[model samples]
Target chain A: MEYQDPEDFIRDDSFLLYCSGKAPEATARWEQWLADNPGRRQDVMQARELVLYIQAELTDVAAASATFRQRLSPVSDLPAPVFPLWKKMLGVAAGLLLLAGSFGIWRYISTPDWLEVSTPLGAVKKVALPDGTQMWLNGGTTVKYIRKFRQSRQVVLEEGEVFFNVVHRADVPFEVRLPGGLQVQDIGTAFSVKSRQQISDELLLVQEGKVLLKKNEQHIQTLEKNEGISIEKGTMKTTAVKASPVSTSGWLTGTVALDNRSFSELGIALENTFQKRVIINGEQLKNRSITITFSRQDNLQQLLETLKLVYQITYEISGEQVIIK
Target chain B: MNNLSPEMDVLWERIRHDDAGAVVILYEKHYTDLLTYGIQLSKDLDYSKDLINDIFLHLWEKRRQLKPVANTRAYLFACLRRKFYQQTGNKTQVQYLEDELLQSISAQSIPSQEEMLIAIQHTTEIRQRVQQALSKLTGRQQQLIRMRYYDQLNYEQMEAATGIAVKTIYNTIYNAMKVLSAELKGVPVITLLLFYFEKR
Candidate 1:
């Protein structure tokens, strides 16, 4: 068969096989064709690129399939013996009791002790605490609370970020514990706390009312609405920054705002938001502060494009890694 | 081309004869394919996994009455597709499944800083472009591609399932690929393709 152009070559199964490095005969044939028709090298190259592109378009089914197989194996291994109606009814009754018992145990284990809610990368989970307070857990975040949260309203922001809309109760003050000996006691307020991985400083932004910041049981400072503070990891020194009342809880609405933050900060936020690595290569570039707000709906490509336009930077994405240049 | 390998054929026969071990093998062999196809149709991974489990359980329950299937993979795909369509009531909602699948796959990882950085740079635009390209294809052409590429079914097997002629299947896929290639032009297909192969 004589190939007319790149389109013709791309449409051929043998060309595809050669592109995928699957068929030796196809590769040999393609090599001979390329040798015979030196002028068509560009066409073949384009066609080969298209073939590889098409192959990549196919989903990576192996991981998902393996997970499915593991889940299905147990079901098939069990025998389905014919049971009498009465016996089946008895089994159902026993199963229900077992479920109830397990539920009781689970509640006992989870509540009054500690209930942890974690969100995966790029996901924001909205949870209602036992005390009717609303909490939005950002990606890669975990919020843990005692079972009797209403009676003892204390929660821990273990890692990542969380926004809270506290249910005001003069009798019981809501408290949030941060990593590295930092705490925020809400005085009837709406607030956000961010503690990223490997970052020594934790940020507290209060949207409404007031919060008293503390370090190792010692009062550090009190922050009001539209007020933000950063607590250093070791010294627990507080740096208060005056900012407009902007909701940094944008992940709830699929939007995130970066306000005059460095590239390293943006990298951490992007990593949490997309659940992917965002490596800023140069030290100078990493500290270059920029302010931007983007929607998650635009996806990573559009976000990268926007970044490229703003920063005049390029990026190369390998497997789960984005190297910025 | 029968979809079942010789081992699969023996397992299927044994399953029909009420061999529990054969049922396990059959489930193990086909569960992933069924779940993958189911997720594509259902747009819910957990739901798809459950649906697969239920289907296999039902299959085992009716094993004695099961007819010998020459192409078990095709048969299972048909079963899953039928079941999914019955549940979903609309096929046009498949556009979101791929995105959801990618998100779920990414969520499964707690990548290191470098890995996370790489992932952020990996553009979702390619998948979006692929979806757009797929949407441009005729329904029949799309179906043919799914059967050929996603399900990995041979032309004869697809013909047996969809009742479209084998020659027509080839023609449809050729035309579809041309359209997809054109549609995905100017996108960094080569770089992303290298990354994909490298990951594998």
Candidate 2:
């Protein structure tokens, strides 16, 4: 680390690294080298200054926080953002709908506390939440929320899967509770939550924004756009998904794109979509990774044919069960 | 630059890791170029300034999801261009989006105001000599020098930036520095450099 020439000091990348606040060890070494050889101070600083000459200039070079000071409040001073009064408007709209006899009088009286929305097999339905979130329920999925959204925006994903294009609010969290103590809270984005009896707490896929995932009310993970977490049995893994953008809008478009998923997982997806028992027979193939895109309009037999053509796998359909080998 | 600093990737990594200081460096590093390009496209100084700010704001907001980008200039230019497009808001036609109009954005741009400021600052006698020395350096030398001295890129990163060899970068910068040093003749180069800016 001894340097005689000023050019030698300049030639050393560590010198500039120290100059730009990079590589702390280099800074320490430069500090030591300067202390040991006090005479090199002018040369080192001069070389460093030569590099600074070419530094780009800015109209405003304030610190990052100061630059944004006039526009966005500092994180500490940021009061919770209050959204438009959509919920109150929704209550009025619902009352009008009630007067128009959209709801059966008996049904409205019985479950005035909880409103429910569900989709049958091979069906995709969109429900507008009281808070202005556009929720789309996939086949065989059920979601329930408080009828009027009193305390906070929360939904219970009791069965199957659901996607939400949330109207983001700063303080009022939009949470989806699932079985096995799994919950997903939207962090200003469109996301999905899934829960199944077999898989327990199944999946949390973020389409656009971000979501915080928790298990049994404890914070587990935060997922961002095109990021997802899959839970099987009791194990969970967060992943930065490389699936195509087509997959982000898959369920609603009736085009399901599964990337690097196991055979059994594919079977579970098939069961959810078709409402049939999808059994993967081989232990070797059960965990084999598969990536495919298929339309929901395709029958079970047609999908099996696709699997046969692309993956070279055969399947046997017996009554309501389709077993892949 | 032949005097390569070689640290843009590392800088970008720090920005991705929520290093506010790193992002500030990135902002200061590219802000002028971005504004120049923005103004060329939009033809509005205030709008261009807003677009530059918006680019950095989006960068900070989406830092966590950023993919690894090798070319910082291309990346920022693309972001700035995107912001310009968004500001124009559905052009009456595909005017700027066309490659010719796109090229016009840069082709029409002259030496940035910063370069003009550098020129004005070189009016003093000693600085005029430095400027003379600077002018004598080849175009490649000036570019490599700027990337190295200003951008703080190392030899390898400079190689990545210019597709020139590290040894070549070293030699080009070495030759350029020799010219500057000869002109200064025993003056600490930093003193002249500091004095040159101090006049501002």
Candidate 3:
């Protein structure tokens, strides 16, 4: 076989392949090419030397060691992360509760010296009065009085929820007096008072213990445990309250239970627990009722998905806003 | 009778037989030397280790199918060089992660601080120019370069990972390399390649 130009061999990828010992057929072709051009053997030798020179520096041990360690370390007896998924969820829940409690306290501090003391939606307030009696104001709930609790612990309920841990002084009866002549007289066990306000009329429910209610200087009724009363058109009627716990004070438990409530009302409920404004875009969804029990520990996606199913409503969520259609 | 180097012949034989022992043996013999030389070329130890590791790991994994090596050391070194260039390219995500992890803990303790800082500043300058140069390439070429050098993807393996054709992989890599060679002249490929090699 005649010698091919070493330059031609160098230019061919097969030549590079043969020099690198990559191609099988190229070996026979390289021998023929080497015989054809004995003068070029030194170039092949030099190329081979260059190839070896480069390869001598390449190492795999570090990567192999790293991979081996990475795959093994998880099963090793090292201390696992303290803040696991559940703990993170608990932390979030606790944060929400503390925020609700703080907002409750804030509302009390900001209450003006007037006939009414009420908090906006999602505000929980602790009213520490000059007289030592305490009022835990629930969100969107109001309390008004004509002349303060001078005659008797007298205050009218307008809207939302309140838990009164009243300081019982047998002489001064702590009374959470309500509109339409409805009044709840506490014999001093810690109890919550709730009244939902509307365009007209209100709904009131007692969560725990007992309270004596009255209207227009006439004895009306006494509510005892899981009992509720509705007041409309100057008439207060007692009704059997659903035996469910109120989320108003459930912050301590890290969960908020919402019984059957309209989407509008649920918006208020979420706003209180989440400590953010939850605006429902559609008037049509206002009356759509839903029952959803959620933990502040729950992810936002899960909460939204559950609401989507409960109301048969589709929603678009971005950050905190959930637009329901 | 064989003109090939003894180490190359042994590696080829061991690799052909699926011997993990040979992989380890090969790595142990070459690792430090390659690492040292790679470090010299880029003045960055991490970069050198990274590039060197990639070449060996590739050889280890694909040993059974690898083409015969006349000079395994040179082939490995060439692979390292290509890997180093790839790593040092502008598309490296490794630098940020490495910096983030090491900056707090080892940046102070590590011996290569001044060298690393100089390399980083130099790299940052080259990276801006390379990004501009790389912008001239087609999307396919850019993607191919990213996968091959940046992701350390080989031809057949890249096919498996991306479900793309094997033939297309070579074409992609070739076109990308050609464009890079042309447009990125005078830019430091060795440092970038070394940087790419060191990434996790």
Best by TM-score: 1
Model 3 C-alpha lDDT per residue in residues A1-325, reported as the tens digit of each score? 2223222222343444444332334545776866987777555543332222222222235544444332222212122323356334433443454455633323221122334566776555555343434566766777765445444666667676666544444677777765555667776444555556532334445544566766665667777656665455345444444533443345323355555556776676677777665677777678665676665556766787876786676767667666667
Sort candidate 1 into its docking category: incorrect
**What does the lDDT read for residue A37 in candidate 2?**
78
Candidate 2: Cα lDDT at A63: 38
Off by over 4 Å in 1: A1-112, A243-247, A272-276, A282-284, A318-321, B1-200
TM-score, candidate 3, is 0.37
Candidate that beats the other on DockQ, 2 or 3, i.e. the better one: 2
> Across residues A48-129, which tens digit of lDDT does each residue of candidate 1 receive?
5444434444533554444434333333434454544533443344345444553211111133377666666666655656
* Chain A TM-score of each candidate structure, as shown: 0.62, 0.57, 0.55
Each prediction's whole-model lDDT (CA): 0.63, 0.60, 0.52
Model 2 chain B lowest lDDT segment of ten: B92-101
Give the Å error, residue B75, model 1: 41
Each prediction's DockQ against the real complex = 0.08, 0.08, 0.04
Sort by DockQ, best first: what order?
Answer: 1, 2, 3
> For each prediction, how big is the interface RMSD?
16.0, 15.5, 20.5
- Please report the TM-score between candidate 2 and the true structure: 0.38
Candidate 1 lDDT for residue B15: 83
**Deviation in angstroms for B163 in model 3?**
48
True contacts kept of each: 0.12, 0.15, 0.06
